[model samples]
Target: MFLIVEESGPWKVDAVKAGLTHSLADFRIVESRVSSVETEERIRLLVLGLLTKMSRVRPNNSASDGSSVDCEGHVGYEGEGEDVGRVGERRVNMGNKLSSKQKKKRKEKVASSLQIRNDFLTGRSLTTEREKCYDPRDRTLTFVNGDDDLDFLCEDFKSLRAKMSCGHAVTPMSLTNWCRRLLDQGECRFVCGQTDCHVEWPFEEVCKMALLTKEEMEYFEKTLFRNVAQDYLDVKVCPGCKSRVVRADLSELSVECTTCTAAKKRPYMFCWQCLREWRGPAPRSDRCENYGCINQPLETLRNCLHITFNDVRGVTGCPCIRACPTCGLLVEHNKTQCKNIICLRCKVEFCFVCLKLTEECLKSSTHFQACSTGVAPRQTSIPVWQRK
Candidate 1:
């Protein structure tokens, strides 16, 4: 009988090989070289089980000599072997969503259950043919469950990710915008849909998801240093120095600076993910002290302190949008780019409230009545009705 390893547990190749020594004797032990995806998966599971069992059998934290024990593919406190468990076991992170097992069970339940389609809901199924869900406009899943089964679909199917830093709802269509705007928007809050545990997630977790989902990430995962005893999945952003010379490989430096080629180099170091220097003017806002900040370009002070989720946990209040101190106008507390906000009245560059240049005020056809004039503008000029 073919052996099947459980989710977290790996299989022992030696055991399997030994078991089949006489009986089909030629059975191949699973390895990384397995050509098929299915075969590779099976092999990984067996190895996981094998590695886990091996670690349990020998609880010693190190090789006998203990000159700083460096077990070939192991990590953790050398003296503390109990902490080490399965090899390369990916802990199910229930960040704003249920665990992977739970999600799989839910999907299985949906597949096995008798679903009554809700025709009016308007969408195709993700499991169905691609042409069905191909709606050019919204570019979303629309409806994964059959329209008739829409009502029957579990409410937990909503693993919808939101835009980074803005906290705006997102879909596959908005994925592009999410990556683009992440830097513009500082740490965002992603609220879970479970309703009961409507917890909010931090930006780091969001980036974690992004890096995990990255197309090139799989190739990178293969490059990671694996530990056969303790299981962990830590993804480091690809090393790219956004400065006078950007290095593509991340192995060059653990810390990097986020700066451009032209702008004045600011002292702010790059964040582990975004690679942007943390020079935001918002108070209590610190820096990402990664390496390579010396090459970055910033307009203001370079913040070099790192902030944890707990650091910003109780912190409430939107970041202060400051104005130029001299003009008594609204200023950007931390933004480095000079906007085109022009003060039509002051004739300098500023919107009445903030003495800052609007990056492009004239090109903006939107309404901006001077808040001071008390003249509400429908489009641009003060509204005739509100003027009185």
Candidate 2:
């Protein structure tokens, strides 16, 4: 049994000298004064004072060996013996264990304090103080009623003036209505409402500027992802389950729907070109087995009449309607702007004459001049569902 005293008081000079000269396990008090009687008397007085204090705080129980134990498990004996030194060693070990636990707790607290959370859109770590200061709504513009320089024509343009990343200003209500219209019209990208600006907004920034609710944001993300997937991949909705499925082999028109097959316990296949039940053979590319199964967009691209550019000379015999090289959406030239036209669905700009990307066409020819390769031949090799 050991008596454990928490070290709280200042150490005396004699106690310090004794600690330096003796082993930590030794509990014997050294005699510093030449008079032995005075030293013994002082030791007796110190022991009596400690015992009195301990008796006031704890109930004493005697051990079988005549040592007194307290409720806290501290043991005190009335004699100086070898057992006392062993008790001191045990106290030191207990103190070391307590200090180690305290150090571990402190380290854990520091690690937790330094931890940071990442922003979903920017992929940047944000500290608690910096996160509190972040607000997307702070990006706004004030519009005066009589300001003639303003070009916005919407009714809520004055009430809701939110500035976009492109430095163009738009109203919240107008932005939401425009974006909703785009989604409803099968378009995925959100562009500025300003005429000729056509700057596309990032999805995350659009959500912030529109102040969309949770449900609206979820719907927008889902629809936008589906529309973009269709533009880039050979995807079609299953007729049975209505689940979107991608065609692995673009050469074949038949696409298998795994979800429907699992539910019905039979292999289910559908026509990628028509979105109807597969009635034809395994690998037909021209048309599915179903009667009158044809790619309408491709037919429109192939048989559309040719139109002459009224404003630009030497750019005649171009197709009146052309499929966007990126998304395959049919777009008719307005005949008023340069031969370059922007697709409404995918928001891609391409040359109406050459049916190629506007950037590539402009490398060799001017905006209104004839394409370097002349009008591109009808694109018959690539399927309507596949992008360039």
Candidate 3:
């Protein structure tokens, strides 16, 4: 067998090189002299690490060698044939001086791989060759061991996406292509953590609801969530039309333009059912499309088709979103409760007079008899009226 080794201390170098020739493949025993202080020294360390791993995979022969441990352990020779002085010599033996440069480059590659592994195990975002998978929320791609240092995979979520559905609360960049995968294998319901009120609610937005900020988004990186009943109200947001939500005055609603209720010409409220626009003070409490106030004392609010309701307490300013007509506030939907109308804002039924929700009529009162077109009293029971 051919024994190859660096010219090191005469005794150590010859013995190990000789032992390897007898017990291991002749081509396997290879070594070289590298000064401990030079860049080449690090290369030697890497090679040593590789050698240790390789030895484990292909065990050394014990019968030909002194002992199994001895074969695996150090076999440093220490005589004149072994050249210890070679360790201090510059690695200029290669005919070309540029050889050192090539060796240094190889060492750098090894360092980079070790670093990538480290970052992945610590839950930090690292880019691979194609996409960025690290978002502040429940991103796709199940990171191995919570190690996120993938630097070669993932892509632009929007570009790669194929389609989407409601209540997923998917971000603008979320991939649509994965929609099929998510729906087919969705293990948990995605929840929105906008506030404590929506503590456990579905994250999907309806009618173009706004998303949370970056900082707020980070708060739920690993949290699993779900929604219940009409819990969406807790996550509601007032779309700041033209960024004019704060300074607009709500008092002179009569003189204001329908599209320009607030200072910045923001539509005060949007009819969820018809998508009609409303200006000034919003309904005190009612489902957006259900209306009893349409014929109530307040003529200003009569145009709204929303169903009104009182809170659970049956008082004015009702929190109920569906099946209530006594409230002035309108909810966008009607799903979780009975169709009976209850008024919480005025603490009274539609027959009782409380004007909190009655600020939007063209005339003084919304009574059908008061209209220019004579009233025909039809006993049609609106859904909200039954809930009352």
Which candidate tops TM-score? 2
lDDT of 3 at 203: 32
Order the numbered candidates by TM-score, best leading: 2, 3, 1
Compare candidates 2 and 3 on TM-score and give the better one.
Answer: 2
The lDDT for every candidate, in the order shown, is 0.29, 0.55, 0.27
Collision count for each candidate, in order: 38, 0, 77
lDDT (Cα, 0-100) at 58 in candidate 1:
16
Say which prediction, candidate 2 or candidate 3, comes out ahead on lDDT. Answer: 2
Badly placed stretches (over 4 Å) of model 2 are 1-226, 229-233, 383-388
For residues 232-322, write the lDDT of model 2, one tens digit per residue.
5445667887765656676778777877788999988888788898995787877887888987877887898888776766877787987
Worst 10 residues of 3 by lDDT: 224-233
Q: After superposition, how far is residue 169 of candidate 3 from its true place, in Å?
A: 35
Q: After superposition, how far is residue 274 of candidate 3 from its true place, in Å?
A: 6.3
Off by over 4 Å in 3: 1-121, 124-233, 237-268, 271-388
What TM-score, computed on C-alpha atoms, does each candidate reach?
A: 0.18, 0.48, 0.18
In candidate 1, what are the lDDT values of residues 1-388, reduced to their tens digit?
1112222223222222222122112222221110111124334543444223322221111223321211122223334433233446676655797888988997886554323121101122224411111111223223232222121233322223333333334332233233334322321223433336444544244333332223222322222111100111122332333222222332232233333222446443334334454433322212334344442212121322221122122222222342232232233423222222442112256432322244333344222322222211111111111110
Better of 1 and 2 by TM-score: 2
